[model samples]
Target: MVIAVVADIVGSRKLDDRTSAQRILDETIARVEADLPLAQQPLTPTVGDEQQGVYRALDDALVSLLMIQLRLPDGIAFRFGIGIGAVSAVESVHGELADGPGWYAARAAIDTVHAKEGRAVPGARTWIVGAPGQDEVMPSTIAASNAYLLVRDELVGAMSERERRLTYGRLIGRSQQELAADEGISQPSVSKSLRSAGSAALLDGVAALRGDSA
Candidate 1:
């Protein structure tokens, strides 16, 4: 089956510069495996705040995103992007990972998400290289697109424009210092805004939008 791949960070630069980000990443991976075992997927942790994984079905993938949004701890949030395509091999040799048009498509999706402007939220953006028979086989893609629309609105309602811009800056690989410079503010001011804006409430709003109890 053609599947969608998602990569994300549980906390952006808001995490301490030290080892806490890695611990958070590990915790995020464990949560994914525990919460959605049926997806039967593996996630590769990249850098301190990022992780990559694949899903065999769009519904499972979207559900996983929702779960991540709902479960993140206070002072932590996530920004993610997804790609959809077909792969010849679901699981490959230990050292030789899956790499093909599907993998490339997935990377493209991540790139698209990374290119987005402000904080990354569910359905911030996605890339899809239609696999053979993909249009006919994956009706859920349409549903997922609709779901993303809802997610976007929910995120916007939960966060202000300033918050979104800061989040977007981080997603595009801008460091906290860089974002501060770009906004003509000190790094501490940026940090203060993010904390004062209430990350937990934003996440709760996201969960509510997904029809989950916050």
Candidate 2:
């Protein structure tokens, strides 16, 4: 089964510059895909502030979405819902429309994220759901992934922008010295920032997703 991802801007109606925010989103997706190249169909604007994409695997979606989160600038953010199942396209007057249980599950997942934010977990940004009756995913796996995402989203939401940039740099294999030079700080300071901000743990998570030995 393929993984379908649905994402929409966070607080889009309140943004001062919607056009610029869209541009940043587009550019960020381009950069992350260039570095990671995971999406089977790279995220493309669907309508309004929403975007959609497909991935061949769940790990790819998690890793790419996490990179996008870290790469985005302040004042702009996205929430993602990933659904696993079958997807199809049906011809429509306007164009070929995506229609299937995969998209339906994705919509449900995004709704879950929205509902979650109003509750105790305000930092919630990503979630996953498996289409009912789909043999591709098990309920236990989805539950565990959601548990991981809850904590992951909280840690990422708490990071300062600088910490995010450094984390992204490390994810893409930039050395601490290189990151420090870019930020105009000492290498030791860069290392400290990464450690203190929990970038190492995030990096380790991504590495684990990639099946790299710890």
Best by TM-score: 2
Q: Estimate each model's TM-score.
A: 0.55, 0.98
- Write one digit per residue (lDDT tens) for candidate 2, span 79-103: 9999988999999899989878888
Q: How many clashes would you count in candidate 2?
A: 0
lDDT of 1 by residue, 15-45 (tens): 6653675576567657666745535465666
For each candidate, what is the lDDT? 0.56, 0.93
lDDT, residue 108, model 1:
66
Q: How accurate is candidate 2 locally (lDDT)?
A: 0.93
Worst 10 residues of 1 by lDDT: 123-132
What would the TM-score be for candidate 2 when compared with the true structure?
A: 0.98
RMSD of 2: 1.0
Q: Kindly report which residue pairs in candidate 2 clash with one another.
A: none
In candidate 2, which residue ranges exceed 4 Å CA deviation? none
